[model samples]
Target: MVDKADKTAKVAPAKVKGGKKTSPAEFIRQVQTEGRKVVWPTWPETVRISIFVFIMMIILSLFFLGVDSAFGAVVSWLLTLA
Candidate 1:
């Protein structure tokens, strides 16, 4: 039977076989290659996203303001009853 203790045990990170390190130039080259693979949004897409974000922010702020005002009124009325 498989041991439950072994199933729950944490595995350690594997060590480098030869302890070889990458040079700074090689690291920068790898970074540039990875950066090139990234897809960036166009100007119109960016502007549309920014407008959508601002609209949602205004809507959420108004919603929270109404909710806070209702709660404040309820608490104020409750205090008067005591």
Candidate 2:
């Protein structure tokens, strides 16, 4: 069972074995390949995301503004009562 478990464990590739180092060009190519595999948002998807973020920002701003105004009014009213 222990031997079977060891064999089933995922192992990292020994890319840098024996102190062999990666060159800058090889690193850049690896990065480019990984970037190509990324799922980039389409133009329409990006626009929709931006609009959703903008609307949420506006709503939260208004909510905080109202709360601040209410607190200020309460403080002013307390000062008048004194």
Candidate 3:
């Protein structure tokens, strides 16, 4: 009655010791290699993303304001009942 999926899930991956540890000097070299792969956004792309982010921020601010006002109204009404 055991499912194949359940059986496979019980088996764990083998653990290795000390095979993947990198020296501090080697780590810095790896970091520099990765740093070279980064390409910065063009000025136009940066401007577009900045505008998009600004619009989203304004939208989220309005949404939170409305939500807070609704909660405040509910709380004020409940307080009046007491």
Candidate 4:
């Protein structure tokens, strides 16, 4: 029977073989090809996302303010009992 250590041994990822370096023109061409694949958002979509983020920020801040106030009041009342 195999030992537990042998059964659970880690295997390393294969290393990439070194290949020929790409020329500068080829690199630029590849970059342009990749750039064409990107899909950028329009102005209205960006504005909507920004507005949503701001609303969430305000709502969360009000929630935390309420929680902090409640905890402070409870601690103050407990101190008075001592």
Candidate 5:
């Protein structure tokens, strides 16, 4: 089955006469049409997403800090024993 999105993704070659290139206006119009079809997130939704990601980063940072301190202490104790 052919999907609508896949169909829209394809573009045929522009017609050329006497080796002349296509105009920029046609290219910009095509891009704007495609841009309109995209779905964008709302500001409130974006803020919620940002907060969730920030919290996750803080949690992971604390975890790695604890693991690093434990390793450093063990290495210092082993050097003193030598």
Candidate 6:
């Protein structure tokens, strides 16, 4: 029979490649190197996307408001019949 305590015990972390841990300074250097490789969008592209998002938000809010008003009117009429 297996021991319940062994099943509940914490497992050790797996060893790194070549059993070497990365130093904090080396990690930061690697992060900066990766950051330099990132591509950023132009200002015009950012503005265009922002405008599109704002327009879609306004359109969706108007659509939901119309639907909610219609439903509210129907509920109010049904309550009047009771």
Overall lDDT per candidate, in order of appearance: 0.94, 0.94, 0.92, 0.93, 0.92, 0.96
Compose the digit string of candidate 2's lDDT tens values, residues 1-82: 3688898899987767576898899889999999999998999999999999999999999999999999999999999999
Give candidate 5 regions above 4 Å deviation.
1-33
List, residue by residue over 7-38, the lDDT tens digit for candidate 6.
Answer: 99999898877789989998899999999999
TM-score of candidate 3 to 2 decimals: 0.71
Error of 4 at 32 (Å): 7.2
- Our model 3 lands, by Cα RMSD against the true structure, at 3.8
* Reference-based TM-score of each model: 0.72, 0.60, 0.71, 0.63, 0.57, 0.63
- Candidate order by TM-score, decreasing, is 1, 3, 4, 6, 2, 5
Alpha carbon lDDT at 66, candidate 2: 100
Residue 50 miss distance in model 5 (angstroms): 0.9
lDDT for position 40 in model 1: 100
lDDT of 3 by residue, 1-82 (tens): 9988987786665544555667789889989999999999999999999999999999999999999999999999999999
Q: What is candidate 3's CA lDDT for residue 18?
A: 54
The backbone clash count of each candidate, in order, is 0, 0, 0, 0, 0, 0
Q: List the residue pairs that clash in candidate 5.
A: none
Candidate 4 differs from the real structure by a C-alpha RMSD in angstroms, to one decimal, of 4.3
Looking at model 4, the pairs that clash are none
Candidate with maximal TM-score: 1
* Regions of model 6 farther than 4 Å from truth: 1-23
* lDDT for 21 (candidate 3): 68
Give me the displacement of residue 3 in model 2, in angstroms.
25
Q: How many clashing pairs does model 3 include?
A: 0
